[model samples]
Target: MGAQEDAGFSTRQVHVGASTATASPRATPIYLTAGFTFSDLDESAAHFATGSGFGYSRTGNPTVHAVEERIASLEGGDQAILVSSGQAAVTVALLGLAGAGDHLVVSEHIYEGTRGLLLDNLARLGIETTFVDTSDLDAWRDAITPRTKALFAETLSNARNDVLDVAAVSAIGAERGIPLVVDSTFTTPYLLRPLEHGAAVVVHSASKFLAGQGAVLGGVIIDDGRFDAAASGHLFPHLAHSDRLGGPSYAEKYGRRARGQYLRESVAPRFGPSPSPLNAFLIGQGVETLSLRMERQSANALAVARWLEARPEVERVDYVGLPSHPHHALGRRYLTRGSGSVFTVTLRGGLDAARHVVQSVRLITHMTHLGDVRSLILHPQSTSHSGRTVAERELAGVFPGTVRLSIGIEDVDDLVADLDQALDSVASVATGGRRTDAGTRGSEREVVVL
Candidate 1:
């Protein structure tokens, strides 16, 4: 099915890839078998050579395929590949295009885990990377070297909530003949499809908003199928020469599906990070309500950001949806629907005060994970970015007082009230001010019209 058809987003989510020939189940079934039996020797040889059908669960499965198809349809990509985790998806996507001696350009404000993977793991492999400010197109241009194979950035940076100029970056990549790979974990396909904005490849950490309920861990890479491998052969030698797969080059075999095919057949099998059929099924179920959850979550997050911005204890709030945010106009231009649910705020009293607010919250859980039905809050300087050096953390905009909040589907009034109490408690302790009167405890909760 094509996206141009009469089918809407909600309709596609519900009906796409939910049926299979082997089973009559209305839902996508978990094909738990390790290997598929071939009818004969000729069929086995054909399947092995062309990958026309599933041969091993480590490589492919019906349930996983269903999830891939659904995600590809949602993102408006030519094809998609599912992996075990978000990091795995990122690693595979990078490795599929680049190798030893090649360089990549990445946003400094990306997820800390991803930054670590690129800086540490890929560096160890002799794949060099240059980190730059994603908002600046000139920084991206200056950082691109002859060895640069791809340009990578997040649609909405984790914790920092920085908005990437997708079209500008895509234009730079186009001029340089490099594919632009965007991690759209924060925004999800419901709010913004990166491919539609000229990104050659789009990735997602399905563990976040895509799964919605945070019940499963999975990742996906979608191929926009627009980049020209022939013109950029030196940067992407894997697509140019495929001696490992019996001399059939990736571009020659898969054409526009080259990236997805390489990720599925070569990278995923060797890396052994393929998603389980059950996990894929859970992700498929999560996609059905992605639009609804994102809408409510975005609205709740905007309300909470506004509330936090007005609090005296909050030094600053870093939600792109907020007018006071540095990238608010850019977010409005690129992110038409909403910025995102995950954002950061700094406390007036630094780490101690930030910790107090985190501890005082009643409804929002003080956990590391984001995009759940239950709200979550965390301090990145102590949690996700703890491993980084002081200079590195500062470069990534992770201040000691910074607190990340992943707003959920809770009632806005209740969420605001919870935050108000937490901020008040933090203020009382931070400033050495004692809670004295009845108004101090429940003043904000009471309705007072001027």
Candidate 2:
């Protein structure tokens, strides 16, 4: 409403959150102060009573609000709330709805950190979780109980690239009057829009692709304004009843914005995970080029995944973009832009071989993070998922020899060359000498499909 309506994604990203008033900065400037000054006592009292004006940095800030508004627009949500990190965004979103004695049905293929949050932290708080197969629709239906408050899953899983069926799961939640919360970190809005498929809320770890660079740590929760409070009043009494004074319920007062308002006013402030204004500014800059980075990264990832599949030394390739993948059809249907840039490659030489490739790579950095502009490689078995049991690691497609790669926006030829050199090092160790052949590098070799 502020600028252009029916604008394209690129135009919206650059201009959506910008302030248009005269003398306003073209970019969202960082308001680094801890608090704002009020004109008088009446204004301060009104700000505290309504929770509208920014009285303190913990509750809200101008710079942070700009990022929130921009994300909400790009994601096609009614409102958004930015937090310190992706974990905080997820924590606040769920805690606002579910509490002690409540339950949630979650996908088994999500990030391990989120899994730990559910099992280690939320479990102690009396909230229960049921993990089900990512693509098993009937299993998701059966897992929901009478006390189930929400259905949660990732739009695309980490390392393994298991594409989630958003529409199918949302339908299941809709039948039971439950809200569907999805983490769209891997599949950014450029690749897929979860809200259009009936998801009630979308969350992201903006530290990843949304930032387009691994510099800032931020997260956002986008509420689509469709998780009807009155319709699901029985399950979510918190949104339907007012306990703070004798005012109207959140639903009745805010109507379509009930969930988002609750998250901003109640959960996020109580959790005290306020995002830094500087971080918000950097994240907003990243959004300006999200589509460009995602397109290049997706193409680079597909090329590398195909090139890896052609190598005899490789045991398996778990990229959903490849036709050999089990979820290739789902990826094609949901992720028309690209399957994503992060995926795993299994080696025939086991953990020792993985260590060799991890150490030999010159261009691909061996790091714990993903979605960087520079390509990154990591040994998930020993690093990111090390805390998981052997069976859990296997289920996640992480073996002793498995290596996760997050492809960057670099030229495809250079990326392939770097991988070729690293794989050659592994080949040297495996064969006791370097065996060079163009056909071996280009030929389609049999790979273990999963």
Candidate 3:
């Protein structure tokens, strides 16, 4: 009670931010008011001047702070900033490090929204980005230039399940004094901690596995809290020098937490991606059972991947947990826990078969989102990656028959049975409703499309 203390992940998740103990309510109370009242003008001036108190919800909130603290503790990061959504997280995190004319080296395969952000919106603002294959170290090295401010990638890529070599890429960035930023939404802290693997910064789409229930949307940016301006001053001069009116540079004021502080005070507030206190509370509640949910989901996903691999109508399965995956070794190296619940499976019969599978699934919801408690399936070629060029889609593994699956914590057998029925529907369409023994080598029946 006398001094602040550290705690374990689960403990911190439940109690860290709410530890201030205002009303002695066990659950983190949601401060729904837009602004906090100050005792007098002097207190208000101090709050604004030093950014100590939560004067406004846009800048900070107690509920949101608890979520941020919990995430930072689990992620092994110095500090965390909560935003409205994953898109906002990426936008603020990148802009906090880069500006107009700055360049970013990014993995070719990432969430489509992120691709759009870099190539469409940020591009319009004069920021340039170069995409490199996730596994190509040489390509990553070649893509960097004088203007390159950061290296960005997903810890576990969307749909295709390509596991990023965080340590390898972070080493490359460290050599060049560039910060390596990774989107770790797929592999939440329960599965992986990018910051521990040398990544300078970590971002997450809390709407996914972090929220666990798909009831709220939030995002977080966690810095390793060790970026030194003196070491990387030339590359990140913006953080090292005075950019504010007459205030000291962020690095001078916050030291190792300069980037995080800048994002908290300047970027997130000014950009206005403030998350609702209620959403923060919901997400925080989800964080409580994150590890348990992830364990079950990962197991169910691996089972589904195995079942799909054996199906005759299936062309390929893109899951890092599978031994056949190109990145299985890398995944094993980096992802010690299960390889996440989201992956893609390509059917042999092309777009028609994909549509049939999406339409026929009874238990699996046909939705664009991922990481829900309920199983979800989607045809990414026609949805998430539709705007991308054919070549781009191919590179990202969004084939005509590719259907992305986000496995849930439901019974593995039930999930597989649902897929089997969907596959049978596809087979019936492919084979004129004539049942074949194709997919039914053992227990699964043959599915065909006419």
Please give each candidate's TM-score: 0.89, 0.90, 0.90
Model 2 weakest 10-residue run by lDDT: 437-446
Q: Write the per-residue lDDT of candidate 1 for residues 96-123, one digit (tens) a residue.
A: 8888888999998888788888888999
> Clashing pairs in model 2?
none
What are the lDDT scores of the predictions, listed in order?
Answer: 0.83, 0.87, 0.87
Tell me the tens digit of each residue's lDDT in model 2 across 409-443.
Answer: 99999999998998886755753222333212222
Give the alpha carbon lDDT tens digit for every residue of 221-281 in model 3.
9989998887787877678888757768888888988888988888999999999999999
lDDT for model 3 comes to 0.87
Off by over 4 Å in 2: 1-22, 430-450
User: Given candidate 1, what's the lDDT at residue 299?
Assistant: 90
Q: What is the C-alpha RMSD of each candidate to the true structure, in Å?
A: 10.3, 9.6, 8.7
